[model samples]
Target chain A: MGPDETAGHYLVANVPRARRGQTVAEVLSQLIAHAHDCMDVVCVLDDDERLVGVLTLAALFALERDRRLGDAVQPGFPKVHATTDQERVASLALHHAISAIPVVDAKGKLLGVVPSAALMHILRREHVEDLHRFAGIARETTLAREAIEAPPLRRLRHRLPWLLLGLAGSMLATLIMSRFEGALAIDPAIAFFVPGLVYLADAIGTQTEAVAVRGLSLSHARMRTIIGGEARTGVLIGLVMGGLTFPAVWLVFGSVHLAVAVAVALVVAGGIATTVGLVLPWLLGRFGSDPAYGSGPMSTIIQDLLTLLTYFVVVSLIVG
Target chain B: MGPDETAGHYLVANVPRARRGQTVAEVLSQLIAHAHDCMDVVCVLDDDERLVGVLTLAALFALERDRRLGDAVQPGFPKVHATTDQERVASLALHHAISAIPVVDAKGKLLGVVPSAALMHILRREHVEDLHRFAGIARETTLAREAIEAPPLRRLRHRLPWLLLGLAGSMLATLIMSRFEGALAIDPAIAFFVPGLVYLADAIGTQTEAVAVRGLSLSHARMRTIIGGEARTGVLIGLVMGGLTFPAVWLVFGSVHLAVAVAVALVVAGGIATTVGLVLPWLLGRFGSDPAYGSGPMSTIIQDLLTLLTYFVVVSLIVG
Candidate 1:
C-alpha cells in the first residue's frame, strides 16, 4: 500500500476518546483536558479499545452533566480502517456530513482520527490534482499557485510528456487519413469536413470524459446505467447538431447527398464519442489508474481517429 | 455580489468565544457548555464582539487551567470580509493552513465563522464546477454523483449548447477548408493532415488553457513573464512535434517539399495554439469571468480553425 493508504499518516493521535460508562461530566472534563486540534467528536471505545460509537461535542454538552457517555453516543457513525485511502477518507467525511473521520485498525481498535484540517487539505489538493491531470500535466503540482509560480523549464518538463504522447497519436491520425486518400480523391469535399467532424466529435467525447472521471469515483449507480445514460445523451446531442447541420450543409454545398452524409456521420460519431469517453475512463479506473488519466489529449486523438474513419465511411456510403 | 460572495452563506454563527480577561478554566467551562457542531476553534471577541484573537481547543487544553485566555490567544490569523468569494475564502483557509476562517464585517466585528465542514464542501463543489464548465456542461451539478445520475434529456439539455456552438464553429471550419479548395486540389495529400494538424494544435492549446486558468487566479507573476513563458513552452513543443513530423511525412510520401509544408505548419500551429490558449483564459479572467470558461470546446474549436488556416496557408506558400 502507498503511504497515503496508511491511516496513521493523516491521523491525529491525541484527540479525546472515551469509554461508554464514563459520566458526561467526567468525560467532558477529560475531553477539555485532553482534546487535540480540531477535536469536534469524541470516539467511544469498547473494553478492547474497539470503536463502538461517536458523540458530537454538541450532543454531549446538551446532555445532563451526570449522564453516561454511552447514552450520548450515536452508533454507526462513519469510521475507516487505518489503511484506507485518503480520498476515501475525505469522501466518507463528506457523505456523513462530518468534519472529521475516525480511523481504526484491522481488529477494529481505535487508531486515531483524521482531523478536519487534514480533510480540508485533502479536498483542495485533490481538486488541483484533477485539474492538472485533465490538462495532461504529468508531474503533480497540487496548487494553482504552484503551477503559476513553477519555473518555465519545470513547466515544460511537466507538460511535455502528454504532448509527446499526443504527437505519436497525431502520427497515427495522419496514417489513418492517408489510408482514406482514395476517398478524398473521389471528392475533396470529404476533406473539407475532416477538421470539423473531428472537432465536434472530440468536443462531445471530452464532456463525457469529464463527467465520467469524477462521477465514476463517487457514483454508486451500476456501470450499465451510467454508460447507457451517457450514450443516450451523446446521441441526443448529435441529433440536434446533425439536424442543424443537414440543412446548412445542403444550402452551402447544393448537394443533398453530401449533406445527408455529414449529418448521418455526426450522429454516428456522437454516439461513438460518448461511448468511447465513458468506456476509456471506466477501463482506466478498473485497472486502478485514475479515470481522469483517460480523459485528455491521448484519448482525444484516439477519438479523433475513430471519428475520422466513421465520417469517411459514411460519406463513401451516402455521397458516393 | 453573488450569494457565494457573502461570508454569511457558509458561516456557522454559534461557537464558543472568549473575553480578553477570562482565565483558561473559565473559558474552557463556557466552551464545553456551549460548544456547537464543529467547534474546533474559539474566537476571542471583545465586549462589542469585535475581533481580538483565536485559541484552538487543543492549545486551550494544554495551557495552565488558571491562565488568562488573552495571553494564550494567537494573533494575525486569516480573516475575510462578508462579501468575499467562497473560492477566495477557501483559498485563504488553505493558504493559512487553518480549518476555520473567521468572517468579520467592515468594523472588525466577528459575524461568524466559516467552519471546516463548509470549507471542505466549498472546495469539492468548486472542483466539480470547474470540471463541468471545462467540459461545457452549463448547469451546475454540485456533486459528481449528481452528474452521473442526471437524466439523459437533462444531460442533453445541459451539454448541447456547447456542441451546437461547436457545430457552428465546425461549419466555419468547413468554409475555411472550402476556401482552400484550390490548394487541396493541387495536392490532395495536404488534406491528409487537416485532422491531425488541428487535433494536435487543439491539444497543445488546451494544456496552456488549463495552466492559465488556474495560474491567473493565484499567481502574483507579471503578465509579461507568464505569457512569455507559455509562448516559449508552446514553441518548444511545436519544434519537437514539427521536427518529428517532417521526417515521417518525408519518408512516407517521399516528397521533401510536401513534408516541409506539413512540418512548418505544425511548428506554426503549435506556436499559435499555446498563445491563443494562454491569452483566451487570461482575457476571460481580466473581464471578470472564470478563466476556465475559455479552456473548453469553444476555445478548442477556435484553435482548430486557426490551425486549419495556418496549415493551408503554410502548405499554399510551400507547395503551391
Candidate 2:
C-alpha cells in the first residue's frame, strides 16, 4: 500500500489495553505477562469492545492496585479518528499535553494508539515541511539532510515551480513600472525607493505571515477580531517605519516632497502588507489547504505589487 | 532560579532508575512500589553512580524476569549534558529516535532525563521560534495566540527591531540605486527589472536559508561539499529562471541588450543568493549563535544588496 498521511498510518495496534472491570493489579499482571509496542498509555475498553477511556502509565502506576480500572480511566481523554491528518494528530497531542493519542474508527471501536515515537516523528516532519513550504519549496523533504544534499536538478525541480510563478508576478511588476515611465522621466529620484519600499513591505508582511501561518489554526478568536487587530498592527508598524524614513530621505536627498511621498507610501504599504498576510493564510485555511501554502512567494509577489502601486500613487500626488 | 533555556531546566530527577546488578523482576517490583515522573526508560547506573546504559520499558517488558538489568541495558543510548540548549536536546532526541534523553553531568553521573513531554514542548516551541526569527521577529512568543493577540504596541516591540534593521538595509539599497542613476538615465527600462530581479534573488536565497538553518546542525557533510552543492543549485535555478525571462523580456520590450542584462544579472544573483544563504547560517553556527539568526531579515538584506549590485553592473555593461 502507498504511504498514507493519516493517524491510521502511525497507529500501533499492539498497545496495552485493559477491560474496565479488571482490577489495577490484574491489569498490571497482564501488562507484565505480555509485550506491547506502546506502554505509555493503556486504552480502556467497554464490554462491547468500544473504547471507553485512557489511563496513562504514570496514573496507572500511582493507582491503588485493588481499585478497578474503570475508576482509574481518564474519561473524555483526547482521541482522533483514523483519517485525521498527521499534523492534527501531533497538534492534538500538544494541545492535550499527552504523549500518546488513541485512534478510533467511525463506529467508536478502538483501533490503536498513535505511539509517542510516532508523535515525535510527526511533529518533526511537519516542522521541516512547514519551513520548506514557507521558503517556497514545492515539495517537502522528510529530512533536513535530504533537503540540502539533494542533487541540484532535484532541488531545482522542487524550487522552480514557485519561482516560475514569482517570475510571472515580477513581469506584472515590470508592466506596472513601464506604465510609470513618464514619472521616472520627470524625476529619476522616485525610482530610488522602489527596492527599499518593496523590501520593507515584504519584510513587514512576512512577519505577519509567520505569525498567521500556524496561528490561524491555533487561534480561536473570531475572524473579524483577528483581522482588526492585525490591520491596526500593520498601520502602527507602517506609521513608525514611515516616520523613521521621512526625515532621513528628506535630509539625504534634500527634498521634502519626496520624503513625504516615501513616508506616506510606507504607512499605506504597511497596512496593506499586514492585511494581505493575515487574510491570505486565513483564506487558504478556509479552503482546506495548509495555511502555509498561502505564504512565501505567492503573498510576497502580491505584497510587492501592492507596495509598488502604493508608492507610485503617493509619489504621483506628492512629487508630481 | 531564573528560567534557564537548558536541558537542566527540563530535567526530571524522579525518573525510573536501577542498579546494574538488579534483575528485571526486581526492578519491575521496585518500579511498581514507587512513582516516577518519567518511566519510558530505566537508567542503569554503576556502583559509582555513573550511568552505564538505558533500558526501554518495551525491552524491559520483553526480557526474562530473571535477567539482570545490565544484560538488558542498551549501552551508549543517546544522552545530553545538563547544560545543553533546549533546542539541541530536542534535536538529539529526534536524531536518536528516543523519546526521553538522559541528561548527565561532566563526570558522567546521570542528573535526570528530559522526559518525552518536555521534548515535545521543546520541538513545538522551537518551531515557532525559528519561524518568527526567519520572518525577522525580534522576540520569540511562546504561544501563537499571544503572537497574534498582543496589543499593537506590544507586537511592534517584538517585531520592530528587525524591521528597523531592515529599514537601514533598505536605505543602503536606496543608496546603491542612487549611484546607478547614470545607468537608469541611459534607459528607463533598466529600472523596470530592478524589483523583479531583486525579488527573484531574494526568493532563491530564502530557499537555501530555510534548508541551511536546520541542515547545518543535522548534516555531517563537509562545509565545502554543502556550499559547492548549493552554489551549483543556485546557478542551475538562475539559468532556468534567466533563460525563461530572456525570451519574455526580448519579445515584450524588443530590447535584446536589456533582456541579456536582466538574464545575466539573474544568473549571477542566483549564485550569490544561494551562497549567502548557506554561508550566513553556517557562520552563525560557527560563532555559537543559532544558525536561524543568520536567516530572516539579516541574510535577506545581504542577498538584496548583492543582487542590486549585480543587476546594476550588468545593466551598466549591457543596457548602458
Write the residue-wise lDDT of candidate 1 on B30-123 in tens digits. 8766647557678888788897887666677788988987777777788888788898898888787777888899999987788877888888
CAPRI verdict on model 1?
A: medium
lDDT of 2 by residue, A31-105 (tens): 999998878788999898788999778788888999998877766688999889998899988888888999988
Report, for every candidate in turn, its global Cα lDDT versus the true structure: 0.80, 0.86
Best model per TM-score: 2
What TM-score does each of the candidates earn?
0.96, 0.97
Q: Deviation in angstroms for A305 in model 1?
A: 1.4
> Evaluated against the true chain A, what TM-score does chain A of model 2 have?
0.97
DockQ metric for all predictions? 0.71, 0.81
The residue pairs in collision within model 1 are A7-A82
Off by over 4 Å in 2: A1-3, B1-3
Query: What DockQ score does model 2 reach against the true complex?
Result: 0.81
